[model samples]
Target: MKKTLLILIFLSCIVMANNLPELGDYSSSKISENEEIFIGRQILFQVNQSDSIIRDIEISDYLDLLGKRLINASTDPAKKIEFFIVNDSSINAFAMLGGVIGVHSGLFLASNTESELASVISHEIAHINQKHISRFLAQQERASYQSTFLMAVALLLARSNPQLASTTMAGASAGSVQGALDFTRENEKEADRVGIQTLNNAGFDVRGARDFFTTLKKANQFSGGAAPAFLQTHPITSNRISDIEDRLKDYPYKQRLGNQTFHYVKGKLKALLGDKSNTKNILEENIKNKIYINEAGERFALAYIYLMDNEFTKSQEQIQWLFDNEQSNPMLSQLYINYLIKTNKVTEAKKLYIQNLNFFPI
Candidate 1:
């Protein structure tokens, strides 16, 4: 599962980077910087120690790059944020005491655009910057730091092991339990305000955040089913919706950067987690009917599906076509190189691999 010892990377980056915010910066006084870092480290330790993290390097790097871009635009660029994807298929994400955020694979599949996903990350980054977790987790008189630490870690484990999460969270008293599960309403609003700015600074379509939330709201109301895991914690109230919409009006709309990278990654992720036959049928039908949000992404998924199915020639066809438009996309390059080797063009594959290795190292 990549098994990169996430904590080590987080610490090393923290040590190397400057301008990191103090724990007391906009946070409660109860938790010191060391204590917040310690809690974040423990949570990351559990994340790497667990077997549920996704093993795909592409997904891992895509998240890392996306997250870092957002972080660079946030209040704390040198915060050394760590990103990980859990294997669970729940449309949720959460932030903890430190600059730690985890995204569920289900969130990726559910998010139609890169901006939509980035909006969530932007919100989580705001939560971390506002020190919401440290303030909320440490301020409770009845809950000690140890108890709060376990509660935070339990949140990371919640997707992988609900029983363990429940048991670990039991250490905190009843009053703290609700705080552990959800942020305060005011905290949610603040996060949205700060996150929207972050999104704007990072050049994402600011409306992407609103679109995702609106879709979730409609889906929940129409289905009469429980809200997605994200909504369950980050409750989208009527006020929250109105506030977000009103906030969006502050910025004039314009053309945002193309989401080609987002589309490519999404296509790859869909191929990684989707049901093979069902996914293939959908992609083909989308192409035939031209009923796709991004035609390039659908074709990218088709190539991935074909390659995984060992249809080398068909995969080659898609790769050649994609080269015309996305010649420099690392994911596409990786797929093309793999296609070359699989089709007994190892010499050409090796040369191409070396040529692009330095540029798209991720």
Candidate 2:
């Protein structure tokens, strides 16, 4: 029975390997674009089956918009990209095959501005644009099948049982795994270099990348525990920060203002992930202490919490304050419309929508 089971597994592996697109030319040390897309689709199918993805429409729409902005600025603007927000709270983002990008919810909580978050997206998109994953697979000449299978398995296991995957990888020859890590590190550096240019070209504050790394480093130090998954994968060093800074020196220094939508998304994520009471308390405390640079975000958080809690009266009051203060803020306008619809005030919602369309005829 054991022998038969083993044979079945082996045959299945062979079948899977055969179904994959032909490996890129070994002599050229490259995987063909079609093969890369096929591998990416397979990996994405596995990822979806793991049930680790967050399916919030608002968050998904925001990430897609942000990702496409960066992709548009990349060398390969025409490449199709898909973005997902993972349910995990660990501060991490990764790019998989076929222009797929995953962002952890904790990353939203950790980021201070839209540009900070965009920096991470830009980095992941750069990895995809550069074909780092496919290149890495192409480099595994001897155990390509086993390595590819293990990689997919590792990704599926990462969210649920990372230790198991780590142990499995540790069983491999140290030299081989270490060489892969070294290559990944080199990829990280190249992604950073390319990502910074993409961020700048997309009209985001370039300093956001450096600022985010600095913040992550500080958080890692003060936590007195394991580094966040982002650092574990991206490996932030002082030299890395310095390299980003040096690149920044080439451009004229300009501070880009934070968008209202950035804070709105952050608040919405916090409300969705955190307990209502705790979120409310935290937002109140931040408002009381003036912790945030913009007081508007605190109000937005309260509004979002109220909206989630079905406290339409409170939600409307908070959103109204935001609209009164920032008349041009589209996010606030949308939220208010949502509130009106929820309260069965369709007439009001329709009138507001028409007014907005007239004012901003895109």
Write one digit per residue (lDDT tens) for candidate 2, span 128-178. 888886666666654444346445334433422233335544553322443
Q: Estimate each model's TM-score.
A: 0.85, 0.82
Number of the top-ranking candidate, with TM-score as the measure: 1
Clash pairs (backbone) in predicted model 1: none
Best by lDDT: 1
Give the root-mean-square deviation of each candidate in angstroms.
Answer: 6.3, 5.6
After aligning candidate 2 to the native by TM-score, how far in Å is the CA of 80 from where it should be? 2.1
lDDT (10s digit) by residue, model 1, range 257-336: 67687788778877877588899999889988999888888889899889889998888777787888664788788888
- As a whole number from 0 to 100, the lDDT of residue 231 in candidate 2 is 75
The 10 consecutive residues of candidate 2 with the worst lDDT sum are 1-10
lDDT of 1 at 72: 95
TM-score of model number 1: 0.85
